[model samples]
Target chain A: MSVDTETVRRIAHLARIAVKEEALEPMTGELNTILGWVEQLGEVNTDGVEPMTSVVDAKLRWRQDEVTDGNYPERVTGSAPDGDDGFFTVPKVVE
Target chain B: MTEFTKLTMAEARDGLKAKDFTSVELTEAHVSAMEAARVLNCFVTETAERALMQAQKSDEKLQSGTGGPMEGLPLAIKDLFCTDGVQTTASSHILEGFVPRYESTVSSNLWRDGAVMLGKTNLDEFAMGSSNETSYFGNVINPYRRPGDETPLVPGGSSGGSSAAVAARLALGATGTDTGGSIRQPAAFTGIVGIKPTYGRCSRWGIVAFASSLDQAGPMTRTVQDAAIMLGSMAGYDPKDSTSVDRPVPDYEKALTGDVKGLKIGVPKEYRVDGMPSEIEALWQRGIDWLKDAGAEIVDISLPHTKYALPAYYIVAPAEASSNLARYDGVKYGLRHDGKDIVEMYEQTRAAGFGAEVQRRVMIGTYVLSAGYYDAYYLKAQKVRSLIAGDFKSVFEKVDAILTPTTPSAAFGAGEKSDDPLSMYLNDVFTVTGNLAGLPGISVPAGVDGQGLPLGLQVVGKPFDEEMVLRVADVIEKAAGPQAAPQEWWKA
Candidate 1:
């Protein structure tokens, strides 16, 4: 139930945010306060209550399973910051 | 020619049909109004030129006797919706300079219905904040104020701009997406009608994603009828969006006759929180009284899982938001911060792109979805989400609709909740339950709070039962009477 400074740092990294060391204390405190409030749910007796997933009980309707994406390679790649010859260029991975 | 600012969408349509006013005149008036209200920080981008062109086309169509229901009507779109060749930022630095190549389904639907686009309204960055303060552009002030008041009031958020623009009569109506009360809260704060339709009712394709499961685009307008007309135009099936309901969209306008005879209204015992202001409590009682006068049966119901909704939503929405926003890496369609290495580039880009609130949510989302914590957090939250929905189902067996305060308190000063994230989240407490359960909920201005700011009552309904929800709201809206036009809006 407690969010330590290390956990906060790791979460910040995963979220791609730059949280300075000094700010970690405040972040941890805030996270703990939030978690403390959320802990109120533990008091509710939900034993044997079936977990509901979606509001509508309907299952996902199936569409024709086929390869349909076409004619948009240039358009799709056009938004990328770095692209070359219809492909997205990422940093060198095997070096 | 009628003053375009005073004409509702319905009135405008009727005037156009009767040849009392031309589409061009209506469009020009709105454009001028928007220009005048620029100080409110309402619009992120304006489509004045394109709007004139569309209005001209509608004039031609009307001359040819081929005009449709919404022909020549000027509609403002939230900047969150992607409009081809138009800038669509979810009010985030990440999307700076990003213009969409494709139009979102909702915008396309509006266009197809002949609704002319006025422009994109501003919002909280990524629709993350309650007061609209987190928007990169700046805060949007409420157009409404007590007769002599000069102090600014929040228009509510993250649809603050849309509501403020509508209240200011900058646009006849605007599209707003609600994920955990964004649309409804703003609508309430500004004394307008906003509906979050049953989940899966509106197509999400092309609208910027924020907690995909809870996000729904709906209409924010001055009247219930305008909201109904706009909702009718926007709701439908879309194969492109996986979550869009394939079922037929009912005629929402036809269901707004203010008739709720024989309907059972459920007043949730849990919604009467301990600290709720007495005026809000009085408003709740008044809402029940009005519904009774309309011949609707009122019954006490319990959504025992209500307390769990805020926590469940905070966990679930952030978890989904984390995954949905992953596409915004600097290398994609938005702002990118280049770095010497790939990892450094991503870190810099995300850090530079997202604002403080957004980064905070992303961190919360990422933590809940992390490997070791997934089951304990995300999965557990999902289970609680189910129970929340179940609570609604159980209550629906006894009543046709549930009523509660749309917000704990009326529009607080813009900076009141900004510093406290938990207090800000509490703004959506009564609202998130509907999103979690995927039920249709509407906010109708009920009364004024202690500070004389407008308060709203939320009517939550069973899934796909938006008809009953709107019906109950119509009764409340009638009893509440038309909200007085803010005196400040008329100055100069």
Candidate 2:
């Protein structure tokens, strides 16, 4: 099914991205083109086939939950564009 | 010393061991070439000072006969791999000017092998797009030109920079990551060799994520032997990466016996897609002939799910990408656009930060994974992915490896497919099946197309069988002979 402008607007919001109102119609066209191409996958008969997440069929390996790395808060937070109070700071969450 | 830059990685390593020239000289040759070829816009960042310092250390080690296998070699790194203290952009504005506090597992392994860094190379934004045009930094101009045609072609993405740098002799070797056809297709376009190891062979620890399941790091080099040496250093189990396979990393370089006697090479019937250029088809035929002449048995095979791979790949890749990219929400690192609140801030930052292609993918991913459409899109794609992998599994049981064209055609002019995304995605039709199967695949520059642009042959092998893949690639390379470099119009 071709994507509509309204759905495109909703998708941008769901993805936490902002698409200008002016661009949503064109973006809808682009998404529809891609979707139109991928819709062929629906034709494949995948009855009872398990969805393969990882190609290598190995048990998920686990490890001890311990702090093996630390003490580099200065370096860890160095790339942050905005941070304060010894942590990553975003815009005010509460009014 | 500038001539040293023209030598293959293996030759340069031997030359450095013989003390014919210092590592400083080798580094200087490539560093100077990088400067001269700036018109290509291949490198996103140049580590000249760090390279010189590392080269000096390598020289000291060589003096004492203590340097590692890849000692004194200078190589370009695709920006996807984070280098400590060096800005790693992955050619996306979202991560604009983001310098990692740590290094990626693959680069760390290269450094431990004494490979000096030339710098990080450019790539398609977040390793998206078929051509390098989507880079926020600007497109990487292919160092290649069509025969008698002055139009500059694209070095295929998203590892275009790595392939171009290696082909242009700006670096002896370069690191490239293939999520789809990123590494192999670019290698084909530039007339070099690139090998994408099995999915879990190289650690994805610090590299920027594209599709977690499909992303893999590999070597783009001037020769199959060089690709082997680089892969040997780059592959190994890493505890830091949970998906990294826990197994012994074979000595890939040493395993290059270059003898394919009695080996069964499968030529899949389904690969004869409609409208394939006659030259590409002939090139595939030549690959079959060469393997047969080299005492390898040619067998007809069928990978019936091949036609569905590209569509499945597009869905699966973006679905994973939408999840992986959610972290860049203007909170932790990189670019941040302020807004009324946290949610609006995320919206604004992502809108202004991501390129159009990236945004398009994110939108597609979000739509497909949404509540009502999940099973129809994302889940269906996953089941199709299983069928595709099963095709390869059965084929591998019949033959040692499968041979197919690396790309449907040679490199095209930049912006040629920018208006049409489907055309761009089709460039990977021949290569994406390997990634979907999570197999080791290498592209060897086998022949030049009618336009004199280089074309490549791809070898897909069993999981963790990079040794076999590289060996078969070597046989093809020997039959193909060395390819001449494109004229350096980008040179000063």
Candidate 3:
């Protein structure tokens, strides 16, 4: 399936990456070119195949439901763009 | 001092042990070399001071006979790995100046083994380009230029800077990550040795996320022996990374027994694509003859799913990239572009921060995973991925390893293929299948093109069989003789 300008705009929104209105048309063309190229996979017969969830054969290891680490709020919030007292501060959401 | 910069990691290790030179002296030589080579745009941040400090400490340990395996060995790090307190940008504006409070597990492993940091090298933004052109810092110029031509060429990416640094002897070796031929392709273009160990062989804990299932860290170096030595330190079980396999790390250098006798090597016929230069074809034949002469039986094999590997990679990789990159929302860290509300702020920040290639990928990823198209694009691609992996599983039952050309062509001019995304993606044509299969693959510089640019031959081995891969690569490297070093044009 190919994408148009409107679909490109919608995808940019879903991805939370702002694409200006003028840029959408060219993006739509580029996406369509890639999508068109990948269309060759449709010829393959995948009727009984399973979607690959993991590449390696190892099973996920289970662990006890306990906190092994984490107490340094300062380290966790150290790189925050806007922080106050080791707390991440974001734009107000409540109206 | 220049002689110190010319020594390989193994040579440097021995010299340090014999008291031939101190770590500070070795690191100082590389620091000076790096300063001279800045015109190539290799490093994102050169940590000359930190390197000298670490080297001084290494000298103390060496004097006490307490140095680790990689003691006092200076190496360049791809910006993808978070070096504690050192800027780890992944060569993208989104992560500019984002230093980590803690170190990445792989890098921490290196430091624990006494490796000194020269600096962080640049890469394609978010590890997303074939050529290094997408790096926000600037493109890394290929140290090798065409004969009698002054036009610049790319080093290949997202491990391009690592390849350039090692190729130019600016560093003993450098760390590289391969999601879709990032390490191997660059190594091939730059005429060096690069290996991507089996998935889970190296911990992905600290390397910036780029298609988690496909990304694995390895070494880019001037020699196969050095690659083997470095991979030994880099690969191990890390409990921090949930996907990291709980297995023993082997002495990879020991695997370089340089014997390929009685080993059955498969040459996948599907790798020969349309428009492949005659020089590349000739190089492939030379590689086959070298292996055969080394007492190995060469068999023709068919990975029928090989053609589908690249296309399937585009889908799976971007889908994962979109999800992995979602964390950069301008709220937590790095660059922030303010907007009226939180959502708009995230939009503005990401749009402003990510490079063009990254934006296109995230959009494609979002579209494919959207409600109406998930099964058609994402699921189909994953199913095809299973087929690609299955092809390798079946082939490994017949042969110990597979030998193929590392890339379709030699290094091209910087802007040659960047305009067309599909054409750019085609560079990974021969190497992407290994990632899909989660196998160990290494690119050994085998021959040069007509233009005098180096090309590589790849050895792909079964799951967790990097030893066999290294063995075969060592045989090929021996057959090819030492690659002629790229001229030191940057050293005016």
Candidate 4:
């Protein structure tokens, strides 16, 4: 149940958010408070209770699965922060 | 006419039909009001030119005898919905300058019904905050206030701007997307009617995803009938959205008879949480008394997993949001911070683009979904989600609908809970269960609290049974009686 500073740092790294060391204390405190609130769920006797997944019991409704979206590439790529030749470009990965 | 701000959608539609006033006049009046009330910061982007053009087109349609119920009606859209060529930020820096090329199915449907778009309203970043403070733009001020009180109250959020705008008559009706009480809470805070329709009733194809499973687009308006009219236009099957239900859209406006005679209403015992303001409790009881007076059976029911809702929702929503927001890395659509390396760029852009609260959620979501913790957190939350839904199902077997306070308290002053995130999250506690169950929930103004701010009572119905939910809400809205006309915040 303990979330250490290192764990919090790792979480920040994974989530791609920057956190200052000074703010970590309060952030940790707040996170622990939230976790404590969530921990209240442990009190319920869920022994025989089934875990609910989706709100409705229905399965993922299937579609035609056809490749209908072909024309909007220009529009699709237009919103990208960086794009070239109809493909989104990220910082060079395999340097 | 006193002012366009005082006119309801029904009255405006009647006027348009009678040719007593043109859609152009209505649109112009709203535009002037919006210009005058700019200090409320209700709108993120005002599409006056587009709205005026649409209104003129609507007038032409009426002249040609091809008008619909929503024809010539002006509405503000939440920034979360993608409108073609309009900035759709979801009130987050991550989406800054992101203009969607395609329109959301909900907005498209509204446009097809001839509803003029006034602009996009501000919201909590990614619909995360209960108060409007989390918006990347700025806090949206409530358009109404108690006489002689200068304290700015939160209009409620992440649909606070929409609610305030509609409540102040900046727009006739506004679209709001609720992932967890975003629409209803704000509506309650602003003393307007907001409904979170049964999941799948409206398409989510172009709504900027917050939590795909729980998110639903609904209408926020000054009255129940206006909400019904807007909902009628907004709800339907959308082939592009996989989750959209292909059910027949009902005649929502006509269904509002303000009568719930012999209806079965359930009062959940667990919702009476300790420390709930006595005034809210009294307002809830008053709602029950009113329902009983309407010849309905008021039965006490138990939703055993009610307490588990907030925790489970926190888990599920952040999990889904983490996945949905992963697309916002520096490389994709939105702001990109320049860097020599990909990792640094990703970190920098996200850090720069996402607000503090958003980062907090992404961290929580990432932790819960991380390896070695997935089974204990995310998976466990999903399981609990089912139990919560089952609790509702079992209760519905015994009662027609469940009623609870839409929010724990009335509109708190802006920044009251900005320092305490947990207290802010508690605002949606009563409403999140409906989202977890995929049941329809509506917030109707119950009465004013001791502070003279509004309190709302939520009516929850069986899944896909929005007609019954609105019917129950309409009954409460009428019985609770007319609210004092919202004070004009723009007047000096």
Of models 1 and 3, which has the larger TM-score?
3
Over the full model, what C-alpha lDDT does candidate 4 score relative to the true structure? 0.88
Candidate 2, pairs of clashing residues: none
DockQ for candidate 3: 0.89
User: What stretches of model 2 exceed 4 Å from their correct place?
Assistant: none
lDDT-based ranking:
3, 2, 4, 1
DockQ for the candidate 4 complex? 0.69
Q: What is the DockQ for all candidates, taken in turn? A: 0.58, 0.88, 0.89, 0.69
Candidate 1 docking category? medium
| Cα misplacement distance, residue A27 of candidate 1 (Å) | 2.3
Q: For model 1 chain B, where is the 10-residue window of minimal lDDT?
A: B483-492
lDDT of 3 by residue, A1-95 (tens): 78778888889999999998889898899999999998999999999999899989999888788999899998888888786798998888999
Cα lDDT of model 1 by residue, B405-488, tens digit: 899888777677788889889999889898888989999988787666788899988888888888888889889987776554
Error of 4 at B307 (Å): 1.5
- Pairs in steric clash, model 3: none
Q: How high a TM-score does candidate 1 get?
A: 0.96
**Residue B250 displacement in candidate 4 (angstroms):** 1.0
Question: CA shift at B254, candidate 1, in angstroms?
Answer: 1.5
Q: What is the lDDT of residue B286 in candidate 2?
A: 97
CA RMSD of each candidate after superposition? 1.7, 1.0, 0.9, 1.4
Off by over 4 Å in 4: none
Off by over 4 Å in 1: A67-69, A83-85, B146-149, B489-492
Candidate with maximal DockQ = 3
Better of 1 and 3 by DockQ: 3
